[model samples]
Target chain A: MKLFLYLDRESVVHRLHPVTKLVALPVLFGVAMRLERLETLALLALVVVVVAALGRALDAVAGMASLLLTLLIATTLMWWLFAPQGGLLRDGFQPAALARSAGLGLRLALMVASGIVFLATTRVEDFAHGLRTLGLPYRVAFALTLAFRLVPTFVASGRAVAEAQRARGLDLDHGGLVTRMRRYTPLVVPMFLTSIRRADRLAAALETRGFGSGEKRTDLVEHRFGGRDALAAVLLVGLVAASLWGGELASQPAVQAALGSARAWLEALYAKAASRP
Target chain B: MRQRTRPGVLPGSAESLGVPRAEIARRVAECLGLVGLAGFERREPATLSGGEKQRLAIASVLAMRPSLILLDEPTTDLDPVGKGEVHAILRRLAADGLAVAVIEHETEELLDLDRILHLDAGAVRRDGPPRRLLLEVAELAAAGVEPPVAARASRWLGLAEVVREERFADEVAARGVQVERTGVRPRLATRGEAPVIEVDHLVHRYPLRDQPAVDDVSLAIRPGEFVALLGANGSGKTTLAKHLNGLLPPTSGAVRVAGHDAKKAGTAQLARHVGYVFQDPDHQIFSATVWEEMAFGPRNLGVGEDQLESRILAALEVVGLTEERDRDPFVLTKGQRQRLAVASVLATAPEILVLDEPTTGLDYNDRERMLALLADLHRRGHTVLVITHAMEVVASHCERALVMAGGKLVFDGGIPELFANDEVLARARLRAPTAWRLGRMLGLETLTPEELGAALRGGGGGNGA
Candidate 1:
């Protein structure tokens, strides 16, 4: 029923300028992607978690954990099964390949976690405002905000349509996979029609509200980069630098020793379990 | 000043057109204040209630500072309280010297307007003072507009004019028409059978809400009973009705429909007993043709082809949509689409029917037809439950009234008893039918104009016969 992911809270992360938070997402992703070490990727994920906690968006983040976990497991299994470099194990389990895939999964998880943090702390309007500030056309920014606004409306309309169909004996729950998918095919028509009608109404409403009046639009809530925003932006830049630096430092003796010891511990546990079975 | 105000040019456009920011802000605030939404400048439009959103729409229009404002059926989908609020705002706008024109089918509330332009088939049928035009009952009825009950009462009682409640009361008292206290309470014909729908301690709390949408509510509806679920917006009437059909499970309670526990029965199974008709016909309608729409329900119910064809034909005939069967559902008029929605549900052959605001956005003829259809269904032994804000519909059609307020069942009684209780009416934000109001003033408890007229002609008071 909630229309948006914008959590209304006052905290360090929430207080940062929307542009700062918006910039931090790409920065985190860019650095996390460039880094090959699992330790650095895990460290970036920890940073995202810390920021989300500071913004009191942990609840929202936690709500998404299950979906992220599914993605993680899928990506890890895909990489382990098809890894081109690592040789397969005796029983074709591919432990070394699985380890490499775990690293990739951790990197993707960090990227997704950073995106979640950014959305949870930033209001949709603020994102639009940030876009406007970033020199995007007002119409484009407005469209983005409108898209966010329509998400909840479409969700509610979809629910209503589903309920209406259900009341007429449309049993979506008790059907075969293909049958259910075919049953849902009928739902798309109504949803699309309703969405089109709503779009017409919304366009008329927007025009009546002077949406494209060719005037210099004024924002109600103005955002400025305050001291906290500046500090957060600095910290983000430092974190990105550290992550990139960690990728280079991954070949160092001590870092390699630590990674080797972690792999040893994992293999020892796997061997112990295998021997017991 | 006489230029046609094109849509899409809002007051904000003025600022974009190089108007001073201060001036635009002042105008926006003033307009919002005019619509009683002064402190809602920062509020998102989606978060507003239906009434508030309507008001905000008007405010946006008012911010344009147009000399003339036109609203098309502004109160159609709103609850009684929301309707009243919008009406008050419109009256204020008109009073402020704005040329306010409203096109609406519901005339009772608009009877106090300075002028009314009655239109039919895109032609002006009548244009005159509202009171005079409404009093011409024959012409009004010819145009498919139900004259205000007071106007009908005045015509029947030979009064010169009585559109206003106090004037009608005074005229009745002065005429010495001894309004007989018939005290005819609406009673459900007791079949003594078990109730078809039983709700006990039903409480439904939506996620992320601090309070339950449907607070602990209990009721038993017997077979063949025609009940109106009356409430203001957000009063949980729809929530409670949804529970009966198993559309929504109760947070901490139980609903039994046709001897099946609603919590246990799947909605598809519950559909056999309770058919729920949503408010917006467009939301439920998706078929390429009316026939396809009607066939959807029975097909889902897995009825045989021959029986399904029969069911579809019977439902279409009941809703008078037989001729429109081959036509695309989206191409039909709003009323036809609404009927198609009802027919689609009836195709499933439910024993209990629940319609949510079935008459909304419908013209007088369409509304009467819809109600008549429901009445016919009720006559055939289907228990009918209607969630409506139309007091006149409840007064005239339904025998029992269940009023809800603040998510609680505040009152359950006969229609006469409901109108007679001022406290309950206030709590539920419902207005008594004009006939009921006039009758109460005259110490009678009539629910409709016909009842009042009959009482007057019965020689109860020396005024009429």
Candidate 2:
């Protein structure tokens, strides 16, 4: 994984304070999980896509689309096969079962999409800074930032170890699942050793740099919540409220009738496919 | 008044330290400018090149306004250009009244500093001016330090001690030493045989980057040839080396190793013919004992148990690690670990050896021992390709030199030809070996100090000074 997910772009979503973005992720996740109707879940997914587009993060979304698509397919299939609320449609087409699985799948996809948007818009340093501003200890915030920074370092080290092993004729590709995993197990030893050595050096470097020298640390960049950030927070709170109440509204008679019509249309399409020669 | 410079403090946070933000900004800018990274404020530290990262590290320290800055081998893994840049920065810092102390192994470059402290076994063996101590050849050799080439040449010619190249040349001219204009021609390996490794118009672009790391580069290495690959940081030396061993398949074009297509063959198959030794030995050594480390390659190749012992023993003997076979590899010295890394590859019995900066962090003796081992391998008919920044190693060891610049093969020829070509050197950001530079100034051609001394002594005339 990349160390930093921040895409350099000028957009309203990117301009929001990082704390607002952090708050929006959990709020969106909460709403996504609580909403039961397929239409509400689809609407949440659309909202996430729109936010990603506003942040100029479509490219990142496109890059992750294949992985996300795989997740969507896997989740949809698992839910269709194993969901307790729906029975397996072995005898004939079951529109209610299909709708239930699709709703769960769409809800999961929306949660992941919202997370991607938040990561893409917020810089790692900004996240740490926001955490510090929210009363996290400076040491804890710095450690969190350093962990993010070390992700790339560890990745590069892991690659080096793999390459080194490959050069030594350790065949990692042509093997059974168990055999391949066993081949990779040795790599962990060297990687861990290298990380330990690097940590030692980094500790020395940090100590020499007065990391814990008893001075109150200062931030180079200060973020303040401006009018736009306040607006974003209010919009986020309103969305959360809607998500909490939207489930009851969707169960109302008029909404149920609309969903029933949509379900009939989907069932007809499924039947047509089932009737094909 | 007393001043304290806290290490690891962010240069950007001068405001919370009761300093004005504008003053912090000015200080940061000045420090960055001093380190030659003026416009890289927003660049991630991880994204910077090794040299640039070291410079940035120094810049951060400089931001603290430290009176005395101590750096431990700041140029350990940097390319020659990077090393020179860091040295230049240190010189400037020292000139600006900041006491700069650096722990480095490449003392020849550090000879220009105010004083020299020669240490051996963690004890000071000599302390004096660089000119006096560096020229004391026997004393330095006893102390396990490699004296400057100029000093060695001066001693060989029975002249007074001279450490600097320009001073050595001036002394030679003043004494009216007749240089025979003879140059040392390296023994070029026979070229009639089919090339063992062939790269045809190779191009490798990383997934995220717009441009290729290894551009349209083509080269062929014949059997038993010793070649040096020279380039600055991010100039594609390592990328090109990776292609030879199938560690990295080309994005376009072809790479053939020992008649096998690198792109089609797995890395294991390529490992049988081209053994790649990485820069850091720690990345490869995981086994507890040296014997197990040596046996890893052959074991991976599925060598018979009967032959595995023999192969490990023979490889250990080659690297002179037989005495340390039972010891844990982690406990071995840095030099021993590097030798073990080579021995591990040697057990696979590959014909072509690709080493990426083997002498990077080794002390004088260890570096010499490693080069001697390579020389021994070359004598055993192994085709050796070394990626290195040490011009002296190229001058004394490799028969041919390939220079890369911006991912393209800019120059390929004999080492002397490479040294004499100023344009290629400038493009590649490489300096000629010290003796060769002195020879150029004196209207002669030479690659090593012994050759320069022989030329002054009017030895046999046909390019063997």
Give candidate 2 misplaced runs (Cα > 4 Å): A1-3, A89-92, A176-179, A247-277, B1-22, B154-164, B183-190, B459-465
lDDT of 2 by residue, B1-465 (tens): 101121123463343344455566678778889999877766667777889889988988777777899999998888777788899999999999999988876766777788877777888887887767677877777777787877777665566445467676677666676778763554565689999999999999988887789999999999999999999888999999999989998999999999999999979988999999999999988888888888888988889999998888888899999999999999999999999999999999999999999998899899999999999999999999999999999999999999999999999898878888999999998899888888888788888877777787774322221
lDDT of 1 at A271: 95
Q: What is the TM-score of chain A alone in each candidate?
A: 0.83, 0.85
lDDT of each: 0.81, 0.82
Per-model chain B TM-scores are: 0.93, 0.93
lDDT of 1 by residue, A192-272 (tens): 998888889878866665676766666643567788877887897788777767556778999999999999999999999
lDDT of 2 by residue, A1-277 (tens): 3456668567888777778787778888888888877887888888888899989998887878887788878788887877665646453447777787788888887787777778788777777877887789977988887898788899999999999999999997787899888787659889999999999998887766667666665566556677888888888888888887766777999999999999999999999999999
> Clashes in model 1: which pairs?
A207-B8, A208-B8, A215-B16, A215-B17, A216-B16, B178-B461
B1-465 in candidate 1: lDDT tens per residue? Answer: 111121121344454445564566677778878989877765666777888878878887787677888898898878777888899989988898999989788987887789988888888878888777887887777777877887878776676555477776777667776666675564756669899999999999998788899999999999989999998887889989999889999999899999999989979998888899999888888778889889888888779998988898899999999999899998899888998999999989999999999998898888889989998999988899999988888988898999899999999888877887889988888888888888777778888888888777675552331
The estimated TM-scores of all candidates read: 0.90, 0.92
Clash totals for all models, in order?
6, 5
